[model samples]
Target: MATFNVRPDIDAAVAKLSSTVGTKREIQHLPEVLWEGETVEMLATGVYGKGNGLLVMTNQRLVFYFHGVMSQKVEDFPYRSVSSVQWSGGMLMGTLTVFASGNKAEIKQVPKDQGKALADLLRQRISEATSAPTQAAPAAAPAGDIASRLATLDQLRAAGAITDEEYRDRRTKILDSL
Candidate 1:
């Protein structure tokens, strides 16, 4: 039998990610699967079908990973592919359902607070992604506001929170407003 080992830094990151909702097992494979510019935003424990795993929200996608005895499962829903997200919370737990790519994924037993926050954030991102193409270019911001936004955008790019293409597109839009 082959075993998987996690590096120290990634182990720490996984621990921090699991702190909020906890986990049934160590998720060492997560960092290895993230895109170059992706950043973890939230994580919750849940069950999808008979598999129990972690529901992870990143800057670019929603990822569900389940590590089973003989195999593993991973599913990712990108922001652009997602149509909508819904959350229903009980006293302590919630269910998060994601509609995307002609299908729906339902994850149950998520922490109420984390699930609600993840659902709201996913909805907002989906809205922005779906509406961005048709919307007119943003109006020019005030000089000071523009400076602040530009700085923040630059930081995001530098920190790998946003991809190079995203940085260039946003930078062009900001510069065009001037």
Candidate 2:
């Protein structure tokens, strides 16, 4: 059998998330598959968007995974498509906001240690992607990916977290990117 090792930091992050997210073996192994051959740069908790899950940053993409008692969802934002990365909040609670391919994800109330480092790394990657034309254009997301995003917006609207206007606007933007 061929066996591969998972990074200790990633194991720690998964363990941290599993306290509330439960021990899903697949979830623990997701980063390894999704970011194969890529570097897992940072891992931050206390994210506020898409139901507050763990945020995983890699050299190639930013992937957020949220798990409920029985449901699981993930969102991926490629570095090449990212246009803005902002850091905010106070010393005690930091927030990281990433804008990519017209989608915005705000990860709020992150721990101070990971927040600053994530912001710096994101800024550097965004800058590099912006300056280099070859790497600036990220590959288009798959059609199924767009469909899932639209579904998420619809869920947000159905739950009354967003207005009908907001849903329409976001849906339009997601579609336009395809």
Number of the top-ranking candidate, with TM-score as the measure: 1
lDDT of 1 by residue, 1-178 (tens): 1123454444444554425333435356677677887777766788888888888778788899887778778899888767678899999888999877557799998878778878988898887776765555457668887798799998877755555667788888887787
**Candidate 2 C-alpha lDDT tens digits along 1-178:** 1122466656655444323333244345565457558766666766665466667777787777776667676877777667678888696778888876556778887777777777888888777765654323236878988888888987866754455666688788788878
Number of clashing residue pairs in every model? 0, 0
Tell me the whole-model lDDT of each prediction, alpha carbons only: 0.74, 0.68
Model 2 clashing-pair count: 0
Q: Clash pairs of candidate 2?
A: none
Report the error of model 1 at residue 163, Å. 26
Q: Could you estimate the TM-score for every candidate?
A: 0.63, 0.58
Model 2 is weakest, by summed lDDT over 10 consecutive residues, at 17-26
